[model samples]
Target: MTHETTRIHPAALMYAEEEKAGKLSRREFLARTTALGVTAATAYGLIGAAQPAQAGGHAQQGGTIRMQMEVRALKDPRTFDWPQIAYFAHGWLEYLIEYNNDGSFAPMLLSSWDVNDDATVYTLNVRPGVTWNDGTPFTAADVARNIEGWCDRNVEGNSMAGRFAVLIDDATGTAIEGGIEIVDDLTVRLNLPASDISLIAGMSDYPAAVTPANFDPENMLGNPVGTGPYLPEGLEVGVRATLVRNEGHDWWGYAEGKGAFLDRIEYIDYGTDPSAWVAAAAADEVDMFYETTGEFIEIIEGIGWERTEIASGASIVIRPNQLAEVDGMTPYADKRVRQAIAMAIDNNVVLELGYNDRGEVARNQHVGPMHPAWADVPRIEYNPARALELLTEAGMADFEMDIVSIDDDWRKNTTDAVAAQLRDAGFNVKRTIIPGSTFWNDWTKYPFSSTDWNHRPLDTQILGLAYRSGEAWNESGFANAEFDALLAQANAIADADARREVMAELQQIMTDEGVTIQPYWRSLYRHAKPGFVGWDMHIAYLPQMYKVGLAA
Candidate 1:
């Protein structure tokens, strides 16, 4: 496919022309005019037109596909179950909504939805005729129950608690408020604290899964109930999750006349070692393997496996905890120290080892240029000499610090390279490999260490979780009142153009302050047997099982 230059909107061009004649840029002009956040014109322009699929071919049904995942658990969508396990269960469970292929918001369980003028109230229209695996009617009560579970402090239902807190009015910035209301049997309404357009889009695209109201969180071990086209057949925690077609599901709007084409989907979790999973796919032991690291792409393809390359939705960054002050001093508090660390590491070397030449180096401030509000930030090239100079100037040359990573070969290699680079830059570096289970647990407790974070939903989400005050994931303890204010303003702004300007400003602040040292973005490669087809590669690191089928 040929790459196209992003088309700036006509209004944007007019604004640019006006700016050239002694006014600010069109973006600035529009931001002033609407008094809203950055306008969506630029983002809308950046999004490429949907490409037409090849014609003359029809989809075939019927298949039982076996897949390998790194891990699994009891099929509970509402609980703090593993993501891989949730992805496997999502196939069997129906969601209240579903995302379209083009990333547009669409109705699945809900036939339609209405938003008030202020964008604070959202009324969802639930579809009728959907039944759970046990032949129970799916209703809005189920949606309300799921939302209540997420907002419940005692339940701790996965990351949704924090995420939902950001969306609800009473629930915003707090875990106690219940913002979801059940409006009769087929209708549900959500009242937000602020007007956020992105929330609606995110609800339709990501986080659309809705579990049954009757499914008990504490007692529903190894079993889940949903109105999805598939139902769980068997489940073994940390081992495998299997699903079979529900046959009773008829509510999905996106599927229309097409039901789940597969009869069964078996997700076999293989842990951090994707190499073993790749071997399984090559040996035909598994029909497909997901989130395959770039290093295994060649090996899988070399063995007659076909694969799909999806954009790595997330970037890998080294975060230094600023709250863990040593002798009344935060090492990362000094801008010079952070810059020095950023300049010391060689991203190309890490990419070579981790991605095997398939991934691209990230120089932009945001995760990708596709994000509407993204801006070009100053780049810090790899220069160990400069790094040492900065470290010395900051009087941190003798400072010893721990770079933490999970006890996995890939993470070990990454931290090792970072240690060597920092050492070469004249800083005392100690590499620590914490067990994977304990790493996540301790890292969140704000241990005095640096570690890697996975894919975050959006720039704002990451900012709120990592930089905002009192956030669970705020290990860095980096706080800026100005940054927080700007984020709040951006969240309420309705105009896309105005929002972009604020977002750009936010990115600039993070980069200039050296909040985190983002080096390389990670990519995913999926290897599947030629017989398998229709599986959607999700950027959220979750794979869709109901979409897959065997090509007879």
Candidate 2:
């Protein structure tokens, strides 16, 4: 043993004690101790043979990391609408590509891709020598199957299916044979019905992780399986999910020596208890907590933890289902009623009261002002009198409706503000603050709720997912043949200026016809312990956990 083998990390020393207490397996302890430059005999006084040195020397590994989130259930990667499920999936599942914070494309499982001049045909080439978590070789067939899996309605990944709609004839959910063709062992081609520039944006979409087509729902939603850097070995729905680094996993785009830096990462759901999370993080019981809302900014900063502030082009909107009806007509389905709600609330008030003025008030567009394609559409002026006039004109002077949201402090306050404004506009509104789990998990059950969306590198990414007619995440139940035509038109434009122009027209068209009130955009943030390193906020607002490591 060398001189460096004599020294042990304080965390590793504690982990060794936990191993001795039977809290950790011998293999785990050995991997961790060896990562700290200690052999088994040197680490735990064992009689085993000496082990070889680890590959890298910068970050000390082997500690079991505990992180906090607001997840209710860890199952069903297809329904990963919130941060909880997606965060864990980030470790165990790999996306085809990722969007950088600067709105540039970064290759992941797919090394490179090419598009035809018309953007109708896309050819994808996967990275060489990659294998799934189960040790199966990753190939073009896997990508093709995974693409088909997304289009399968039973898989319930239709939100992602919306992005890959070129593969399916929307009118009949039938696969267009040439739409997604496996060209070779490591190559696939996408022959779309029409030109769509948004195809590149789908590479980074959630549930973009490639999987074997034969992977049933049990393996997909219950015990997770993928070609990611890590694997959630024994994932249970409501309880904590334990992710172990796949030591033999040959991930294509691993930046660090072995990709996942930590040996074990545990996701602990704190539900709606922010104080419990803060206390755990402050005491080093947890290394990270997701989405530290602006209301808790002062408290997190006071705890002296490092926090990230990414201008999340994320929008907060009151989404009306537009499906509940009255005399064969959904009230919110009326453009005038939707416009009335937009004119009722002062978005700045909600920002100040609920968000602590930490975000930019949204324009009529769903896109952030930071994006190059942003177009400042006319916002319905904040006039409660005008809102009343519009409602009265629609013969709904004192209409009654229930508004729903999460029970969290931030959402509660925001919903309260929104409800008060809507009430003032001669609408009878009852607010229902459901649990965080129910709010996002059972989103389809409710007709109206204030929704929080994450940032997308391109507006078309979110548009294709949330705004398009028949999109799986179309919670607003909004549909318009004209809007659909303009959406395709926007995505078909290859020229930047022409795309922006079309995007502007789409923005105005949606504001004048859709069932939503874009109040403001949130400033997304995440807090980490002092010992954490290499963490970055992706454009998707999902933290990049692949590069995280404990400082040496």
Candidate 3:
């Protein structure tokens, strides 16, 4: 029963030992190992656990796995407005890496990668013999093009610009001239200006889907060129999307007996109502859910379908826009006002009212316990009396504030709970609920709003996206030179223990500044019928349909 443990990374081996010591869950152990380039089968072998039924050519390859999710419009991969759009487009578009359910990563378009000791340079080894559905050879140039597009802030609605900022010059919004180097047909090198340990993890993000060097946004739907296994057959926005397997070409992973197991994949829009999905699941109309909220978990379970859960950093941030103004005054610009808003509401109450208490109460800091670089920082106590004092000191005691949120059940409930708490604290509060279609249009521009941020493997990744000055997705308009500097210092340190020391300071700064009231770290769930293999709940809500199929 000897496993192939010799080639496992030292860090992954350490994680295995920790698992043996009862310090890590099996899922967590596999996640760390797969992220470090060890295959899932090998990691399972090391623990003497049976591999998934689909692994090693045991997969049933011809059934469909229909999921209940919104089918949003498809456009440039970098400008995907919502995660559902990314999840839908992911059927045809693939990333360089796959972030697993347990916060680990798996190689996708790129075979493997190596990062320097200081995390300044990343040598990406592109998977050879891979080709687009149209038979175009996939190469390092395609990878370079995708990276360049992500680093370009000039592209309107390019959400990836913030995460790719590490490779760009501050003066120029575009990537540095020599930041991406094509070493050969199969190798690509990244020369980062600063050390960023999250760069590789960032690639697995939904928006980082790689496209051909000459990809055209206008013809995206007509001729979607990707290295994935599925091709768009039908896409009726807000209704349904049908993706059929690329029978014309063999997927790159087929030889490895990994993903591309399902013959057809379907995404049906059940709207924002969980009740609609509950009924649909009961009727056997949908095989699984894009995500199962706490309110419907019991109903879905009563249907006898199995569920997978993962503790993730996915959470909502209710905060005021520091850069926006109201009545010729920027009330939230004062840190005291933001701090007062955070202090007025109890996160535990919000969790109970909004999520049915399905998650852990989160401090104002964005970092979560699941992240490798997480540090235990101070917690902000719920103190309405102190909150009122801070509000009076900031000259906002009577200033009315508006809270905006999407019209979905969980989000609206969460925002309503916060607004009620704020009103109870003697502050004037207003609530606005808008449709999902229109809400994301001006999401970042809202004076005060709640935004659901997806999970990133490292805390630094999410910080760069949401808090970094002038980044495209900096919804809170939070900017501090000192905090940014500390983040840079933390990103450069690759060792988790070393990075954690810096993370402690970063977490303190985030809480002290009151950037956002991050109420809870969500526990993501998904339910699938019996006999389905390889379909697991992803922490980030990424739809990894290529790996899913029913048993033979």
Off-target runs (Cα >4 Å) in candidate 3 are 1-59
The 10 consecutive residues of candidate 2 with the worst lDDT sum are 1-10
Question: Candidate 1 local accuracy as lDDT?
Answer: 0.59
lDDT of 1 at 312: 49
Q: Local distance difference test, per candidate? A: 0.59, 0.69, 0.82
The better-scoring model by lDDT among 1 and 3 is 3
True lDDT of residue 363, candidate 3: 92
| Residue 20, candidate 2: alpha-carbon lDDT | 70
lDDT of 1 at 190: 77
Q: Which pairs of residues collide in candidate 2?
A: none
Q: Rank by TM-score, descending? A: 3, 2, 1
lDDT of 2 at 389: 91
Model 3 residue 136 CA deviation in Å = 1.6
lDDT tens per residue, model 3, 494-521:
6676788999999998989989989998
Best by lDDT: 3
